[model samples]
Target: MKKFGILVVVFIVCVAFLSSYANADVETEKISLNGSTSMEKMVNALKEGLEDKYPELLIEPQFTGSSAGIEAVLNGTTDIGNSSRYLKDSEKEKGLIENIVAIDAIVIVTDTQNKVNNLTTQQLIDIYTGKIRNWKEVGGEDLPIVVVGREAGSGTRSAFEEILHIEEQCQYANEVNETGPIIAKVQSIHGAIGYVSLDVIDETVKPLAIDGIQASEETIQNGQYSLQRPFVMATKDTIEKQNEEVQKLFQYIQSEDGQKIIRAVGLVPTSNKMSY
Candidate 1:
């Protein structure tokens, strides 16, 4: 009887130890990604897909613009920052690590009612800076142009201005907080014009050709669209140096399946050949 009691107690202890080990091994990983409004739908989809595969993982995403996201990662506020532009040397000097996740064509959009079908980069710069106020000046109906833009910290805004050399001179008539807001405004206000990721364009807005090239998926992929920019996943040392879970999350993002998800969100996928 004494032997049997001891054996039972040992069995219970072994079972408890095994269960504890299993729980520890199956612990959930949580990550926080912050950045571009342009990548919101894609990031959300990533969260959903990752969750479905690894129910133990949790992903929290925040949209504060690409610059803000990169800053957040540098400041240790987020595990990853979503950027529509590459990280600058200054950013890298600050210990910001970048992972190029995808490519996106900065699409020029106008109110659906507007008849303007295309614009040259120079023409876009001219129209936005209040230099060319009338649509007829650019082959459209005679109407005053209403320029809408993203806030200064936006990656989309940064890339657009960078390409046009208007980072300092382009004057915006209105600055919106998010891509959705900009899209909605452009769709409703006749003569209103703005730019956003191609995924965000809908029937309510008309996409304008750039340099006679339409900002379509094929054109963007073929590099005919000059406004194509890389989407970056960035992290500070917290993720790069110390967090195992962050490493795992980033690994999933850089995986082939992840690139497919990025493409499905209406952005171009960057080949590993490009520098991050």
Candidate 2:
């Protein structure tokens, strides 16, 4: 009987040790995200939402330009590259895959003090092309309109110029690298105007009504917002080809809960939860 009791105790100890080891295996992993300064808001939303539900994740996001992000993923330097625009055909040929995470509008903002509240599509084009150099040309104060813009190679710059159909023809008074600093520059400089992601706008600047339509989630969803583009994440391989932890991160982004976060940030989630 004593021998039997000892055997039972040993068995219970072994089971407990195995269970503890299994629990220990559930620890966290690190995830690296790169690219797209324009994707900061959306990626931050994803990071916050996913990290809460998955405490085992350490998500690090780097805000490089869209092209850099695509290159990073294709070169296997990072697990994911966030982009504010869809992948170009040239990038597609590089075996890079774009995963559309959400839809964002490119909004034209002037200083809050500027009286100009609306602009037609043609007028915005003229303003950037330097044909309309003064605020009064667009029905604002008599101050000279300072056209601020993103630097060359910026996704925001590409989307803005492309949608406006001006391409490299824009006559910018100043060029900035990121959305945040541009807002500050516009706030300090009178008659300053610039374009940024819709979600980044605040009381600091005023959005101009484009073609009598405001850029909002509903307008973006219904295709009424002409300045909208897809928010994307580029990967070297399909979602299935990523590591298990990376796949989980993408899964959380497409989950219903993840969509809620995107909506709360004033960007529209992809209709089917993922795209591109």
**Who wins the TM-score comparison?**
2
Per residue, candidate 2 scores C-alpha lDDT tens digits across 152-193 of 988899888888789989998899888898899888888899
Model 2 CA lDDT for position 95: 82
Error of 1 at 82 (Å): 1.6
Q: Any runs in candidate 1 off by more than 4 Å, and if so which?
A: 1-26, 237-242, 271-276
Model 1: per-residue Cα lDDT over 47-98, one tens digit each: 8877776788889999988988888887778888889887899998898766
Candidate 1 lDDT trough over 10 residues, lowest sum = 267-276
Number of clashes in model 1?
A: 0
Q: What TM-score would candidate 2 get against the native?
A: 0.88
Angstrom error of the Cα, residue 32, model 2: value is 1.2
TM-score of each: 0.85, 0.88
lDDT (Cα) of model 1: 0.82
lDDT of 2 at 260: 89
